[model samples]
Target chain A: MKAKVTVRLKSGVLDPQGRAVQHAAESLGLQGIQEIRLGKVFDIELETTDETEIEKILETLATKILANPVMENYEWEIIQS
Target chain B: MKAKVTVRLKSGVLDPQGRAVQHAAESLGLQGIQEIRLGKVFDIELETTDETEIEKILETLATKILANPVMENYEWEIIQS
Candidate 1:
């Protein structure tokens, strides 16, 4: 089984990297870009095929290591191949 | 208009970050995690609603700024709200 996890900063949180990217875009002559927020994606492959077990494992990983709960949020889905 | 861009390392590319994360997970007592790959996501908001123009702008950003063509690949979709 595979899991795709996305972790993003919560609203109102300051993102310096996003700001830097925005500035880079402007310098590159790419117009109309109003805002940008940067996030992370984790592609995980597990040895098990149990959906329930995979969900449980992913939940723990996302909260414990993948995201900063105080400032970030995460969502994940199981991928079928 | 909004654009969600996902950038990932191409297959066969070495990812030290992913390996570090895997080690961290093992230390945390999370089992069954076979492999992991880390990627980046960008949420961009544009001032214009023109689809054609937005695609052109995002294409440039994804190619030149958001991803390294030699090692990484990127995909983006326009979001309407």
Candidate 2:
């Protein structure tokens, strides 16, 4: 089974990288770009096919290591392949 | 309009960050994780609603700024909200 985890900054959190990207967009003549937020994605290949176990493990991984509890939020999905 | 850009490392690239995360997962007692790859996601808000223009701009952004052509691959989608 394959799992994807997306970790993004929480609203109101300062994102300097996103701000820099926004400025770069403007400089590139792509105007009207209001906001840019940067995030991280993790693609994982699990050795097991048990749906319940996959879900449980992904949940733990997302919370424990993939995201900062105070500043970021994370979501995960199982991709059928 | 909103645009989502997903940038992923090309296959065969060495990802130390992913390896570290894999080790962390093992330490956390979550076994059976065969491989882990890390990537980036950019959530962008644009001031225009023109679909064609959005596509053009996003394509440029993805190639020139959002992704490293030699090591990463990128894909974008326009989101309707």
Instruction: Please report the candidate that would top TM-score against the real structure.
Output: 2
What candidate 2 gets wrong by more than 4 Å, as runs, is none
Candidates' C-alpha lDDT: 0.95, 0.95
Where does candidate 1 clash, by residue pair?
A: none
Q: Across residues B1-81, which tens digit of lDDT does each residue of candidate 2 receive?
A: 998999999997999999999999999999999999999999999989999999999998999899999999999999996
Ten residues in a row with the worst lDDT in model 2 chain B? B56-65
lDDT of 2 by residue, A1-81 (tens): 999999999999999999999899889988889999999999999999999999999999999999999999999999997
How far out, in Å, is residue B8 in model 1?
A: 0.4
> Top model by DockQ, which number?
2
Residue-level lDDT of model 1, residues A1-81, one tens digit each, is 888999999988999999999999999999889899999999999999999999999999999999999999999999995
Instruction: Give the Cα error of residue A17 in candidate 2, in Å.
Output: 0.3
Model no. 1, DockQ? 0.90
For model 2, state the Cα shift of residue A38 in Å.
Answer: 0.1
